[model samples]
Target: MNTTNLIATIALLACATGVFSHEKSPHHAPKAAPMKEQKEWGIAGDVKDVRRTIAIRMTDDMRFTPSAITVHEGETVRLRAQNKGKVLHEIVIGTQAELAQHAEMMKKFPAMEHDEPYMAHVRAGGQGDVVWHFNRPGSFDFACLIPGHYQAGMTGTITVLPRKP
Candidate 1:
């Protein structure tokens, strides 16, 4: 081959070697093991009481199971929220705007007391209970206002239907 062709061939071989050398480097070594997936946990469901007590369970999937609840006006509801997860969760009962405002306030105050209506913030592997009386018939949302928990579908609907005459 000519001198120029020989040099060009040498340059191409050098480039190919450089590219293959990267695969043998330790920095490009395969990961020791695949990362384990993180588990997301959230509220379980909404409970209604025709008698007195209502039970709800929070799962470890960042969602409310029931997603909807129905109750009669003028009835007292005893809501039991159990966090069966590895993260903190809360149960807040209010309108959409009220819950939004409460979420904002929660951002300002992490340890703020939630005494309005009925609410509870439970830690991981903990449980909370709320006794609320629904005097009026309307639609309410039960949610968890822990940062991004609410937006993660950790909410339920409370439908307080009017009592029949």
Candidate 2:
């Protein structure tokens, strides 16, 4: 081959080698496995190791469906609340005094760190869950502390019964 042709051939070979070398390099790591999606919170109840799931839908109308619930004392309950309305809502479980304190704190702190053990706030188009263990046999009230939601009838009752022998 002539000098010019030899030079051209060497350049082409060098380009091919570079491309193949990149493909063979160990620097390119294999892609990681996709992460598992986080589970969304919802209402669930346990009975003898069997769990029953319930859906509580909230609306701008300011009401909770099946506004009454009955459970045995010392039972574990999982409540999933979904806001299907244009306004924010919450499901708070406490005594009359506790609820009052929560409302007052919410007013002052707004996004204050909630110390209540059984309360969940669900914003519009959002959902949340609350797991509660009823240890006492009494009438408990669940209400939304969203400004006027409670006054607008966004409240319900939970009756805990005595444990059966």
Candidate 3:
């Protein structure tokens, strides 16, 4: 092949091998802040510190089972999330405003990629989990900020009550 054709062939092969692939899944999120960042919502939890386990099911109907969860302040809950639908799903933990903003960004950038300690992404019939520390007392949100998923109502609440004296 000519010099130009040879270079084009090499570039094509590289692309075919995913050498330049940057596409990402909707579950992709920004790097989670450090555990000691003192978030208004809470922090990532340690598996060993989990006080209990809870299940959150993602359905194709754009819903999450047990739409609300309650936890005590300073508690860590291990969440077992399952995608019972026929599509991809995820559970992203954040405040209502945060989730809403993330969802809007996801809608604009469908292929955004992110992985954090407080997010779980699963395929159809798949399962995932996250350990979260409810260190503060307030209401937070957990939603599937996967493109249209959050807009379709795949959101839940986490109510953290103050710890007893």
Candidate 4:
């Protein structure tokens, strides 16, 4: 074969190999997200470190059962959220400002993709939980940022009290 033809054939085989490798390789699995504390929201806590567990229910009515909760500063909590509704829902914890910003973004991009440690995307009738350490003394918020969910009033509060000396 001529020099130019040889180079073209080699490039073709390289492209073919790149495309076929995925079909043969066991290493094509999706990458796992690294475990990291979301300190902007709060430190990530372990299940064993949970000082308390609170049950929260989400409904099609766009509300959370026991929509308000309190915890002492530096306390670790396991928030168990159950979706009782007939639609997909998610629980995202953040500051009220953050929630509002995210909610607005969701409204604009209803199918936006997200993966966050402080967020739990649950299917209908499914349940999930998050272990978070509220090391800061302040009020935070949790909401369902599924487009119209937040506007329909799917939000709640977390009050972190001052630590007792």
Better of 2 and 4 by lDDT: 4
lDDT of 3 by residue, 61-141 (tens): 999999999999999899999999999999999988888877876775576556677888888999998888888999998
Residue 103 lDDT (model 1): 71
Instruction: Name model 3 segments beyond 4 Å from true.
Output: 1-36
lDDT of 1 by residue, 1-165 (tens): 667546655875686687589878878756353232211111222345335767777766877656788878777777778888898888887788777866765564566444433677777889888767677787888889887777677889889898899
**Clash pairs for candidate 3:** 28-113, 28-114, 29-114
Report the C-alpha displacement of residue 97, candidate 2, in angstroms.
3.0
* Global lDDT of model 4: 0.84
Question: Residue 74 CA error for candidate 2 (Å)?
Answer: 2.2
Error of 1 at 35 (Å): 50
Off by over 4 Å in 2: 1-50
Query: How well is each residue in 110-135 modelled by candidate 4, as lDDT tens digits?
Result: 76555666778888999988778888
Report the Cα lDDT for residue 6, model 1: 67
Q: How many backbone clashes does candidate 4 have?
A: 0
Number of clashes in every candidate structure?
1, 1, 3, 0
Error of 1 at 131 (Å): 0.6
